[model samples]
Target: MPELERDNEVELAYGVRLRSSGVSATVGDVRQAPTATRPVRGVVADELLGDSGDAVARLLPVVEAAGMRTVLAVPLDDVQVPPTPFGGVRALTGEENYVELSVPGPDPDEGQVVLEVDEVGLVRWHIDVEAAATAVAIADNGTALAARGVAPVRAGIEQTFRIPIVQLDQGGVGGQQRGFLGFGVRKVLHLIRFPIEAAAAAVGKAVVGWWEDRRRPHALSLVTPESLGDVPPPDGVSAARLAELADKPFLVLVHGTFSTIRSGFAGLNRSGGGQPDLAELVARYEGRVLGFDHQTLHVDPTTNADWFLRRLPTDRPVTLDLLTHSRGGLVGRRIADPALAAAAGVPTPDVRRLIHVGTPNGGTVLASPKRWTTLIDVFTNLFSMLPEEVATPTAEAVIELVKQVATGVFNGLAGLTAMDPGNPAVTAANAQVFGGGASGAAGAVRAITSDFTPAAEDLRLRALNAIVDPFFGTGNDLVVPTQGVFEAGDYRVTDPFVVQSPSAVVHTAFFSDVRVRAKLGEWLPGAV
Candidate 1:
């Protein structure tokens, strides 16, 4: 390698080329230098640049003054896994640590010539490919410490650099010489998610739940409110509130996930004006619209259902019509269960109708580790379950392994865990209400589900669908698949309205669909 000699100090420089797939390009200018370099040695704590900044910032003054240009960027836009038959292949890149530092040597006018680089940034990648690297990671000499968060997963990549072998007295360009020198290596950061620790915990819990399901599955039948533990006492509707129902029925509007009274049922207040939200509009259909806001993240659906039932007005001025969105659908079905309603002190027949919009009755692809594993298990089991041998492996058995492997990848967050359709607790409750083909209490309560989504029409949605469509299916309202709102036997009992429109009705926008309110009014018989 050709080196630069100025004031007796030698600075090494080299040229590099990047190749991936079938395309190739030189590295882009470092938009931002990474903070840490791999193969860390004797360096003090304060010098590390991990928390908020890049390590390149510290080296820019020295490297720039040395007259060298540096650049970095992901070739081909993104390093993504190729799609496969089991839906979209979901292989994640571990860490890309190999950083190619390209430096142009000093001009002939500078008069001094000589050189060899002692270090190159780290080369990090999946364990499978880590061994096949050509770079070395090393620390800078005394005092000049590397920044933070920039340690490549795999280090010590070896490579050769091409430098021009020049004549000391020459003014014009001359022949080239190739030399292999190791440059300081920095780690690559994927700043899109939570810390590694939190992610691991989520996966651990998800796996435990997945395994637990086989040991004890959900009842999938009517359960009493008393059975739903830790459910907060139901909020009671005042006499004035019940009196308002005299004009119509009790239109209970329940919100799912992260929403509150004002933001959810009450409808958010926009700048100048806004249309009535689900609660307000649905109220017009039969009677007074009441909001059911529960702590979604920590509490599961059953617990929330317990709280939901208790909050109701003891004696209604009118009949009851239950309407729910997203996760709210889970609670709605539980409420419609004859056993649960009776336990809550209301006659099962008193709660007459169930209307669900964008409910994840089947399961949610997002945060439902069991669902993702189910994606793999479904296809694997399809072929695995062909044989009917008594001692042979079964699909149910395979689900445990698949779920463990899959859910273990992402710890089950409390909210996601509670609503996970695959979880025994959630599945048991659902099966009791939705699985066996009827919408609670046989023909006692009439039920209907309306699903609306624009699909992958927009560019952003298209990109997102590319990643999730494999699990959630192609038709989704961004969060849950519109079809997931309905179970396998749902059509046998509940009337389904799957809107096919070129116009997109996004997740939050489902409440704004004029058709939903109108349909509720038509389907809902006037007061009892």
Candidate 2:
């Protein structure tokens, strides 16, 4: 009979014996659960001697005396058990590892999940037992025995198993540390099922649901390019391209939208009186030049940005001078997260001297109307089976497109609002910033009113709010009207916004202003 000590609970070393396809092998004692203390040696001795007949033969007297047993006690060449008396454990030979860990269950539950780590030093084998529940037994060598009469391993419950390694204590045995990425958190799904298939489906659904919830961005934007060109590079202007950038005050150029590094640099080179090429820009400055790729609205910006950053080398230091056009600014701001900043060892941005060219710092009324309409349409289509007149109409396709649109618009709105000083979200974001000065907020605001408005009678000033409004009410772009940009805010009639940036002017009078390039050169001296 197995025995236990009065003062201490003996550790009964547990394992499995498996045989399949006419082959059999032994597995050694393996741990089924984490224990606070090492188990008593006496229990191991009784276990090895009791059930595993053949294993009892090789149990080292010293270890056997301590109550430890190997898994494959009997040789595969011999068949002794009638195979009928076996109730909880199944024996298989020649199929993979002969051993399988088995645990009987009235119905699958967290309690029934079979967990085991890789063995060390000897009996090295590759096994996986992550969050898994199984009707099986495991050996120190990773050998497992399936439960004789129980159903196969079910889903919803994870099974964690690993192979043994030569090193017992160097820490990375069986890649245990790497495999358990989601440590300390409960899996969102915990359902029970029969035959394993149904349970697996439940688990898959839960994972997909969790992923969907995290797929969208709260806000986003598509930035227009910023220009820093001076009138036709006069004779000396050519030198401007070669001008030393050290203490000369660098103008960090950040690209927006779907531009690549090559395209961004080339566009600047092709643009006006002309400035330095990327190489020249990098050469002239004492500081390093950097570029960033924000997540695509059409794609997940958060995830894309992560991939972008993952490819960057941020270990080195670079001087800070920033100029972001369009949506690139949102990404630039996010890198300002406290933890991220601290980990990267970067100082908070000095946005006081910061300047934006064609940045839509405030929510763009023009964009908002399109976005709002899109959202409305999405809701409409989701509820109806009618063919959408919109560009694409397949249910699945529309759903994906809508998700992308929503992510882009929401992130754009959030970024815009957060940049506003009096905005609540902005205040919350700054709570953790060192010195806590409000984030810089400035950008072009297109005028929705006509110059002749004053001459006309019966004009009542209104807050710029939505797209349909004629005068710069909430939603208007200069042409679209203020109503398009409507949201709760301090916008009012007396201090109405006016479009003044050179880019905005260029946008309004591209052909009329033949001197637009000249204006660009004057405003942005470092642009080509």
Give the top-scoring candidate (TM-score): 1
**Residues 189-294, candidate 2, lDDT per residue (tens digit)?**
1111111223323443221122232332222111222322211111221212322322243444444333322233333343334443434444444333444333
Writing each residue's lDDT as its tens digit, candidate 1 over 148-205 gives: 1212222223222222111111112134222111111112221110011223234533
- TM-scores across all candidates? 0.48, 0.31
> Number of the top candidate by lDDT?
1
Q: Model 2, which residues run further than 4 Å from truth? A: 1-253, 257-267, 273-290, 298-316, 336-339, 343-353, 365-436, 439-528
Error of 2 at 73 (Å): 78
What is the C-alpha RMSD, rounded to one decimal, of candidate 2?
A: 26.8
lDDT of each: 0.37, 0.27
